[model samples]
Target: MFQKILIANRGEIALRVLRACKELGIQTVVVHSTADADAMHVRLADESVCIGPPPSRDSYLNIHQIVAACEITGADAVHPGYGFLSENAKFADILAAHNITFIGPSGDHIRVMGDKIEAKRTAKRLGIPVVPGSDGAVTEEKEARRIAAEIGYPVIIKASAGGGGRGMKVAHTETDLEIALQTARSEAGAAFGDDAVYIEKYLEKPRHIEVQVFGDGFGGGVHFGERDCSLQRRHQKVWEEANSPALNAEERSRIGGICAKAIADLGYSGAGTIEFLYENGEFYFIEMNTRLQVEHPVTEAITGIDLVHEQIRVASGGGLSVRQEDIKFNGHAIECRINAEDPRTFTPSPGTITHFHTPGGLGIRVDSGVYSGYKIPPYYDSLIGKLIVHGRNRVECMMRLRRALDEFVVDGIKTTLPLFRDLVGNADIANGDYDIHWLEKYLAKGE
Candidate 1:
C-alpha cells in the first residue's frame, strides 16, 4: 500500500478519498486551487498544496502542477477522485513517467476506453453487444447520413471522445441529420478536441444502467453489480440506485459478465464503470468510465466494500481481494447528489454557508467537504455533497432517502434538497416506472 497519496481533485470526492486513506493508514496530500485555500479537504488532509489559480485550466486540470505537487509531497501514488484530469490518459502517462502510480487504470487503457467510438469497437470485438449504428468514425456528413440511413431515422450523433452528454445531437430525418452532424462535429471538436463523431440508434425512454467492476490490470476482474442512473436531466445523472429494479438476475449476470470481460480484455485495473443503455429488454454498451464515479457510494453501501481502498490496493500491484463468486449484493442503496443550486431554476447559488447540517443515523452516509461558514465557489462544479442511504430493499431505501434528504440542511445558498424531496415523492420514481427523461418531464410539470 502507498504510504502517502496525493488526491488530484477537490470537494466531496476529495473528502471521500481522504476518508478511505485514513482507514487504510495511508497519509494523504490534497491539492487545492488557490480559490480553495480554505477548502475542507485541504484542512483535513495531512498535507495540502495549492496548484494554481481558480480556473480549472490553470489549476485542477493542470497536469504539471498536479504532478509537481505529488513529487513535492513525496506521495507514492496519485488518486484522481473523479472529474477534471481523472480520465485524462496523458495525466496517467505523466504519473507513470514520474515513477508514481496512478490509482486507476493504465494510461493505455484510459486512452482506449476514453474514446467512445473506439470503446464501442473494442466491446464489439470482444463479443459485447453494442448499440447498432456507425461501425467507425463518421468523418464526412455523407457517411453520417449513410450510417443514419442504415440504422433508420432517429439516429444519434455522438462525439468519439465525449461523456456527460456533451457533443451529442439527435436527428429524426435526412434534413435533421445534415444540421445535427455539422453541429455535433463542431461541438465535439470544441469540447474534446476531436472533430470525429459517430452514429448510434437512439433508444427512446432507455434506462441508464452501469456495471461497477474491479480488475487487476491483467486478465482477471470481478463485478460488484449494477446501478440504475435513469433519473437524469440533460443527460447528466441526478440520482442513482444500486441493484436496479429494472434488471433481473439473468439480465444482471449477462451484463456483469460482459462488463468484466470487456475490462479484462483491455487489461483494466482498479475501479471503473461500464455504462449501458437498456431498452426493449436488451443492453447496449454506451461507454466506460476509467475512474471512480460520483455515485460510487451507493455501490459501496450495498456491497459492503471500500472502493477507494480497493483502488489503492490495485494500484499497489494487488489483485482483486474478492472473486466473482464471493461478491454479493446485500441490499438496495440510493444516492442523491446534493448540489448548491436552485431546485427550480437549476442555476448555481454559490455563497457563504451560514448554517450546514447533515443527516446521520443508520444506513445514512453523507460524503461532503464543506461545512458551516464555508463559502461555495462559483467557478467549479455545483455539487456540495452526496447523501447516500441503504436499506433491506428498494422500498425501505427510498423511505430512508426521503427521511435523510428532509434532515439535510444548508443555509445561505439554494440547494436541490427540495427537488430531491419532490422526486422521491413522484409517482414514477416511487414505482420505478421512469426513464432517463423522467426528471425533465417532472420538472416541466413544476410538481
Candidate 2:
C-alpha cells in the first residue's frame, strides 16, 4: 500500500493527480521547480519540495532529483504525471531500483511502446492495422526515397522517438523526401537524443481517434470508449470529445475490442491511450501513450471513472475494481484546453491572473492549476485549465460547453478563450464534419 505519493511533474495534471489521491485518503508530496512554487499542486499537496531551477531538464526530467525528493519526503510511490518522464522507461526502472512504485505500467511495456518503429511492428504482429510506412528506421536517403515511391508520393518523415508534432515533416514529392528526412533526423536528435527516423504514408484529412484502455496485467482488459481528438493544431489536440460523432456503436465496439484485446495480450496494466488515424471507415494505429492523456478528463466524464485513482490503485497492487462487463458508457462529453495565449496568433501570455472565476453548474468541470493572483511563469506549457462538460448528448454537451466558456473569466493575461468562443459557433465543428486538417485551414482563413 502506498503511504505517500510524490508527484514528479507540475501544472494542471499534477493538481489532477493530487485531487485523486486526496479522495483516496493518500498523502501527496509535490516536487516542483522554482518557477512552479506558486503552482496549485504545490500549494495543495501534503508536502512540497523544490527539486531544482525552473528548467525542465534541471528539475522535472532529473531522475536523481526526483528520487531524492521521494526519499526525503517519505513518499512510497512516484506519479510521473503525463509529460516529462511519464513514458520514460529508464525513470520507471530508476523508481523500481529505489523500491518506490511508479504509478503506471511496467518498465518493459513503456520501453517497447515508447519506441515508435518497434511499437508499430508490435501492433502489426497483434493484428492491429498500422499506417503503411517503412518497416524500420530508414538510415539512407535512397531507402527513404524508395519507401516514399512505394507509398506513392505523399509521405511523412517522423522521428521514431519523437512526439508533440516535432520531428515530423510531410513531403508530397520525391525531390522533397531527402530534406524532410534530414530535417526530421536533425530535429529528432535535438529533441529526443535519438536521430532514428522513419517514413509513413501521409494520411490526408483523417480523424484522430483514441481508445482509453485499462489493463489488469492478468489477461483482462477494459475499454472506456473512444475520444475524437481531430481538432488539433501542429499535432497538439485543441478540442476533444467522447463517443466520437464519426463512429456508430458498431464501429466503436469493433475498434474498442481490438484495443482491449491487444492490451490484455500484452499483459499491460494501468491507464493507456491507443491512438489512431481514421480515414474512409478504417482505423490505422498511430501510437500508444502509456500514461494518462491530457484529454483524459473527457473519457472520465463519460465513464464516471477517476482514471488517476485507478492508476494509483493499480500501482499499489489493488488490482482492477471494475471489469469490462461492469463498464457503462454514459452521456457525451467535450474538453477544451484553455491556454494562456493570444486567441488568434497563439502567442504565449504569461503574467498574473488579475481576476479569475471558474464556471459552475451541472455538467461542467474545470481542471486548473492557477488562481487569480497566481503568476503564470513563462517557462512552461501555456495550458491554464481544461474546460470539460457532459450532457445527455453531443448537442447538449456543446451547449453547456458554450455556456460554461461564456461564464468563464480570466483577466490580466490574454487567453485562447476568444478562439474557443468562435470555435463553438462553427457549423463544421457543430456537425463534427471536420478532419485533422480542418482546424488549421479554418484558422488560416481567420474563421
Candidate 3:
C-alpha cells in the first residue's frame, strides 16, 4: 500500500480522494489553489500545500508546482481526482520520471485513448461497435462529404481530440455539412490546437451510457457496472443512475464483459470509464474517461466498492483483490450533481453560501466541499456537491431521490435544485423514458 497519496485537484473530488485514503490508512497531502484554502479536502488532509493562485493554469494544472509539492510532502503516489490534469499523458510520464506513482493508467494508454479518433480505432479493433463514419480524420471537405454520404445524412463532425461537447457540429444535409464542417474544424483548431476532425453518424436521441471498470496493469480487473447518464445539459452530466433501467441482466453482462476485457488487454490500471451512445438497442463506443468520473458515486452505491481504494491498491503494484464474479451489484443508485448555477438560465452562481444543510436518511450520501460561509470561487466549475441515494429499485430510488432533494437546503445562493425538483415529478423522467436530447428539449420548451 502507498504510504501517502498527493491529491492534485480541488472541490468534492479532492475530498472524495482524501476520505478514500483515510479508510486505507494512507496519509493524504492535498495541493490547492489560493482560492481553495478553505476547501474541505484541504481541511481534512494530513498535509496541505498552496500550489498557485485562483486560475487553474497557474494552480491545479501547474505540473512543476504539483511535483514540487509531492517532493516536499514526501508523498509516494498521486491521485488526480478527475478534471485538471488527470488524463494528461505528459503529467503521468513526469510523475514516472520522478519515481512517483500516478495512481492511474500507463502514460501510453493515456496518450492513445485521450485522442477520440485513436480511441475509436482501438475500440473498433477490439471488436467494439462504433458509429459508422470516416475510417480516420477527414482532412478535406470532399472526403468529409463522401463519408457523410456513405453513412447517410445527419452526421456529426467531432474533434479528434475533444470532450465536453466542444468542437462538435451536427449537419442535417449537404449544404449544412459544408458550413458545419468548416466551423467545426475552426472550433477544434482553436480549442484543441489540432484542427483534426472526424465524421460520425449522429443518432438524434442516443442515450449516454458508460461502464465503470477497474484494472491492474497485470491484465486483471472487474467491471463494476453501467451508469445511465442521459440526463445531461450541454454534454455535462447532471443526473446519473447505476444499473441502468434500460438494460437487463444479459445486456449488462455483455457490455460489462467487453469493457473489462478491453481495459485489461490494454494493461490499464486504476479506475476509468468506457462511455457509449445507445440508441435502438445498440451501443456505439463514444470515448473513454481515463480517470474517475463525477457520477462514480452511483456505481459505488450499488456495488459497495471503494473505487479510489482500488486505484491506490492497483497503482501500488497490486492486482485486483476482488474477482469480477464476486461483485454483486444490488439495488439502484442515483446521483444529482448539485451545482451553484441559476436554475432558469444555468449561469454560474459564485457567492458566499450563507447556510448549508444536508439531508440524511437511509441510503443517502452527500459529498460536498462547501459549507456555511464558503464563498464559491468563480475561477472554476460551479459544481458544489453531490447527493446520492440508493433504493431497492428505480421507483424506490426515485422516491428516495425526491425526498433527499426536498430535504437538501443551500441558502443565500441560486442552485439547480428547482430543476431536479421538477424533474422528479415529471412523468417521462419518473418512468425513465428520457434520451440524451430529452432534457435539453424539455427545458427549452419551458415545461
Candidate 4:
C-alpha cells in the first residue's frame, strides 16, 4: 500500500478518494484551485495545496502544478478522480518519470484506448463486435461520402479523439453528410488538435450499457457487472442503475467476457469501463473509458466492492485477490447526478447554497462537495452531487430513488432534482422501458 497519495481533482470525487484513502490507512493531500480553497475535501484531507487560479487549465488540468504538489507533500502516488487529466496519457508518463504511481492503467494502455479510432480497431481485432462504418479516419469529404454510401444512410461522424458529446454530427442523407463531415472535421481539429474523424452506424435508440472491470497488470481481470445508463440528455448520462434490468444472465455473461478479453488483450491494469451501445437485442462496442466513471457508485452498491481500494491494491503490485467466480451482485442500485441547473431550461444556476439538506436512511448514499454557504463555481462542470439508492429489486429501487430525490433540497441554486424526480416516477423509467431518446421525447412535449 502507498504511504500517501495526492488527489488531483476537485468536488465530490476528491472527497470520495479521500475517504477511500482514510479506510486504507493512507495519508492524503488534496490539490485545489483558488475557487475551491475552503471546500470540504480540502478540509478533510491531511494537507491541502492551492494549485492555481479558478480556471481549470491553470489549476485542475495543469499537470506540472499537481506533480509539484505531490513532491512537496512527499506523496508517493496520485489519484485523478474521473475528470480533467485523469485520462491523459502524457500525465501518466510524467508521473512515471517522477517515480510517482498513477493509480490507474499504464501510460501505454491509456494512449492506445484514448483514441476512439484506435480503440475501435483494437476491439475489432480482438473479435469484439463494433458498429460497422468507415475502415478508419476519413481525411476528405469525398472519402466520407463513399463510406457513407457503403454503410447506408443515417450514419454518425465523430472525432477520432472525442468524448462528452463533442465533435459529433448525425447525417440522415447524402446532402446532410457533406455539411456534417466538413463541420465535424473542423470542430474535431479545433477541440482535440486532430482533424481525424471516423464514421459509424448511428442507432436511433440505443441503450447505453457499460461493464466495470478491474485488472492487475499480471494477467488477471474480472468484471463487477454492468450499469444501465440509458437515462441521458444530449449523450451525457444523468442516471445509472446496476444489473441492468434489460440484460439477462446470458447477455451479462456474454458482455462480461467480451470486456474482459478486450482489455486483457491490451494488458490493461487498474479500473476502467467498457462502454457499449445495445439496440434490438444486439450489442456493439462504442468506446472504452480509461478512468473511473461518475456512475461507479451504483456498481459498488450492488457488488459491495470498494473499487478505490482495488485500484490502490492493484497499484501496489498485487493481483485481484478475489476471482471472477466469487463475485456476486445483489439487489438493484441507482444513481442520479445532481447538477446545479434549472430543470425547465437546463441552464446552469451557480450561486451560494443558502439552505442545504440531504436524506439519510437505509440504502441512501449522497456523494457531495457543497454544503450550506458554499458558492457554486461557474467555470467548471455544473455537477453538485450524486444521489444513490439501493433496494432488493428494480421496483423497490425505483421507489427508493423517488423518495430520496423528494427529500433532497438545495435552497439557493436550482438543481436538476425536479427533473430527476419526474424521471424516476415516470411509467417508462419505473418499468425500465426507456431508450436514449426517452428523456428528449419527455422534454419535447414542452417544446
What lDDT tens digits, residue by residue, belong to model 4 across residues 144-258? Answer: 8888889888999999998777889999999999899889988888998987999999998899999999888887778998999988888889889999979999999998988
lDDT of each: 0.90, 0.92, 0.91, 0.90
- Candidate 2, residues 121-230, lDDT tens digits: the string is 99998778899999999999989888888888799988999899989999999888888888999999999899998999999889999999999867778898999999
TM-score of the candidate numbered 3?
A: 0.99
Q: Which candidate tops TM-score?
A: 3
Q: Supply the TM-score for candidate 1.
A: 0.98
Return whichever of 2 and 4 wins on lDDT: 2
Give one digit per residue, the lDDT tens place, for model 3 in 308-423. 88888888988887899889989999999899999878999999999999999999999999999999999999999999999999889999999999999999899999999999
Clashing pairs in 4: none
- TM-score per candidate: 0.98, 0.98, 0.99, 0.98
Clashes of 3: 0
Scanning candidate 3 in windows of ten residues, the lowest lDDT window is 213-222
Q: What CA RMSD would you report for each candidate?
A: 1.1, 1.1, 0.8, 1.1
Over 4 Å off in model 3, which ranges? Answer: none
**Sliding window of 10 residues with minimal summed lDDT for model 2:** 215-224
On the 0 to 100 scale, the lDDT of residue 435 in model 3 is 92
| Candidate 1 Cα misplacement greater than 4 A, ranges | none
Question: Order the candidates by lDDT, highest first — what do you get?
Answer: 2, 3, 4, 1
